[model samples]
Target: MGKTVKLYVHWVDTFNRWVGRFAMRLIFVMAAIMLYAIFSRLFLGRPVNWVMEMSQFLLVSYYLLGGAYSMQLDAHVRMDLFYGRLSAKKRAVTDAFTILFVIFYLGVLAWGGFSSTEYAWSYNQKNYTSWAPPMWPVKAIMTFGIILMLLQAISAFFKDVAIARGRPIA
Candidate 1:
């Protein structure tokens, strides 16, 4: 492999690993927020105004940002019936092809999301809610998240290619 490709793979892998670890905390934060909301509503006789909106934001952010991490860990759901039976080389080949499709899909989303995020930032768009939180952050997150996923996909592609060619990836 070229030095540039190896560098990219290393960098993307490192970034995804770090970010994925950080993202695990988001689940706890989301859970805490929900617990607070539940307690406040039941005991205090009023729901938290920002709970729903905050949860939506947290959930989306968690899913989008943590995608690369999930991919790295091979934690994403898949039909394992046939896949599990495949040999290492076959599995690598299959993964490479599927990752190509994922790259294309994420590329499209990232492209559109970038434009939308730019528009939101320029216009200072805000969600139409009682909280009226600015939407640009989430939009930016969506764009950036997809980009990260793409980078991680490239890293995975290289590893799979190595496996397919019977080469040591590391």
Candidate 2:
């Protein structure tokens, strides 16, 4: 790989790692909110109106934001039937080929997410709920996360190409 390609990979990997770690912390926040909701409803005899909605928001954030990191770690699910028996180089070749479909899928997803975010921001859209939180923030986050995942997928493709070429990126 060229120096620029290596640099791009390094930078994307580093940024995604940091973002993924940040996303991981959201789980704790979600848990805490759920616990508070449970406690308030049972002991205080008062159900928090926004707790469930907020928890769902946190979950969406966690899943979207952590996607790239999961990809980075190769933690995403795959069919292991024939894949498990392939040699490393063969696996890299397979990954490089398969990731093109993933890249295309993510590209479409990112486009839709960006459009949704723009609409939400422009129209000041709000959820049709009692709490009625603004939708732009979550939509923006979703778009950002999708873009990050797309970048990571590209990076993985590059790495896989290098591996298939017998010059693996370190």
Candidate 3:
């Protein structure tokens, strides 16, 4: 691997690690919100209208933001029926090929997310709920997450190619 490729991989890995850890903390925030809702409804005789929707948004953000780090950790689920028996190099070769499909999927997702975010921002769109939060922030985060996942996918492809070529990127 060239110095540039190694640097790119390292930077992306580091950034995703930070973002993923941040996203992980959002789970606790979501839990707190839920608990607040429960306490308010039970003790104060009123339920928070935005609690469920806010929790859903947090959940979406959590998974989307954590996606690249999951990929970096090789923690994503896969069918291991035949894969488990493959040699390391063969697995690298197979991963190189399969990651193309993932790249394509993320590309489409990013495009759609960008478009949605643009529309939301242009129209000042808001969720059709009682709380009615503006939709642009979450949509922008979605686009960003998809793009990060795409970048990580490309980085993984590069590493896999290097591994398949018998020059694995450390």
Error of 1 at 14 (Å): 1.0
Per-residue error for 117 in candidate 1, Å, reads 0.9
Clashes of 2: 0
* Model 2 lDDT tens row, 1-170: 99999999999999999999999999999999999999999999999999988999999999999999999999999889999999999999999999999999999999999999999999999999999999999999999999999999999999999999999999
> What local lDDT does model 2 show for residue 134?
97
The global C-alpha lDDT for each of the candidates, from Candidate 1 onward, is 0.89, 0.97, 0.94
- For candidate 3, give the lDDT of residue 126: 100
lDDT of 1 by residue, 10-107 (tens): 88989998888887788889999999999999999888889888888888888888999898888888988899899999999999999999989989
Pairs with steric clashes in candidate 1: none
Indicate the TM-score of model 3: 0.97
Per-prediction TM-score to the true structure, in the order listed? 0.91, 0.97, 0.97
Model 3, range 18-98, lDDT digits (tens) per residue?
998898899999999999999999999998899999999899999999999899999999999999999989999999999
> By lDDT, highest first, what's the ranking?
2, 3, 1
Give me the candidate number with maximum lDDT: 2
